[model samples]
Target: MKKIYFFLTLVFTGIQVQAQKDFQGMAVYESKTQAPKFEGMRANRDITPEMQKNMEERMKQMLEKTFILNFDKSSSIYKEEEKLDAPGQQGGMRIMMNSFMGGGGTFYKDVKAKTYTVDKEFMGKEFLVVDSLPKLNWKLEQETKQIGGYTCYKATAVKEASKTDFRNLRPKNNDDKKPEDKKEDPKKTSGETKTNFQDNFELPKEIVITAWYSPEIPINQGPENYWGLPGLILEVNDGRTTILCSKIVLNAKDKATIKAPTKGKVISQKDYDETVIKKMEEFREMNRGRDGGPVMIRR
Candidate 1:
């Protein structure tokens, strides 16, 4: 009986030691809102008719875009470890994004740059950029918080918003409101709803974003346009909707290869957004429907 109890204690200690080892992972980000003030827009139940009309007109000309970021777990190295692939790590990470008006999606490839050897100049660099304009930042803050079963940390970062062009959108006119046409089609008789999207004018104030990272699996990566947290960003709230990392996996048996996408030309993050908007406007114009150009979808 004494021998059995000792064996059990030894096994538990071994498990704890293994859990302390650094790990690699991939997390998916799901952003619910396009802009910071979207919630306020939703709450405005007392909007006036003219104000509503203008909002609707603007929505017709706006472009919608989404971005996803993938990270390379195999590119990471631990302080006390050598430079070699861990048990089940792989190549790199990829992010996928889509634009509504612009007819496209973007994939970020090879986010983990080539790992450096031990005792080299760039030894402790955490974040790496494999494609697109390079971005490098580190994971900091040592405190831990519970995220699922793994312990995560509170991490903060300031990243510039991707630059997208809001200029020269497809011009659209309010739909003709003839009484005869309205009476003829009961289903389409209702007036269009409007929304005042604040995408134009001055750039938004520098965003202060916060996220939770997990140290249980030591890879400093996350999904959809964010990385560099000490642990993976389990939840990110940037004064908008909260993007929680619903699930995370580390060192699974089958390793997934992370690679850069060669589909679109590599441009600066800002330029990329702008180009997508411009392309969307062009697409709208080219395929304007039978009702004379792009009909104002809202007001």
Candidate 2:
């Protein structure tokens, strides 16, 4: 009985020690100085009905835009975490997304975020929490560098073009041109027609996201919209560079329990992508008939 009790005590002690070594420090992504360019995406259509519904319902829910992530770095398993929110425009509509990675590989959640404004001391700014999927398979690249006294690697990834079945954007009588069809379609006689709008951009193209992971941290996590690295990503860049862990304080005096937040609708990343496309198409079709905007239109 004495020997058995000693073994059980030793096992419990080992578990406690392992639990203490997970991810515990805050990984900071500081935005470096870059010249701002005034490029705009002109969309003739407005927000879709579905998107409008979501905006109306959940726009007021507070989100954590910028956060200080805390975790336990003692063990391979990360069971808890916390996100500390700051005050700013991009800070309020922020969300905590959870993804799982292991021998089974990484799986992401399909989450939708509404556009919102969080008042800041400087000025009122806007940010968007778009619903998207993990279309790219992320892996470590050969180029490596040291960050926060730990070795990190760069990874390249991309999201492929997805085809969606949405509300019909094509004209109803596209295939049929009989005499009866012509008579039935009065709008055809009027010159108003649905025009095919082409949005030209490359798809399934490579998107470069430079991430520096530290083996010292030992937890697979990152910032903004990325993860799946072997260690905590200290820095990540995709043209617009987001450098994380520019400053890290190890063995700080605070105990931050990092746990995934439970909120927002969780769906497969693919489903979320499809929903976004469907909404976009619906919005475009609804606006196609407008002339010089709705306010100016007589009818």
TM value for model 1: 0.46
Tens-digit lDDT track for model 1 on 1-299? 99999999999999877755433344444444343222223325466767766654444222221223334453422121112433443312111111321122333433355222211111111222223423545446677777677787776666554334122232232254466644432323355322223221234334556777776655555544455555566766554345665555555555544443333233444444455557656765565442322221333
lDDT of 1 at 273: 46
Taking all chains together, each candidate's TM-score versus the true structure is 0.46, 0.46
Alpha-carbon shift of residue 24 in model 1 (angstroms): 6.3
Count backbone overlaps in model 1: 19
TM-score for candidate 2: 0.46
lDDT of 2 by residue, 1-299 (tens): 99999999999999888756532565544543221221111223665666644543332232112234444442111121244543432432432111100001111222222111111111121112224334347776788788767787777665432343111112133344566554443333344322223222112223356677777766655654455567777876654334456566555777665433333444444554455556656766776555632211111
Candidate 1 achieves a global lDDT of 0.42
User: Candidate 2's C-alpha lDDT?
Assistant: 0.42
Deviation of model 1 at 13, angstroms: 22
List candidate 2 segments past 4 Å from native. 1-23, 31-67, 73-142, 148-151, 157-206, 239-243, 289-299
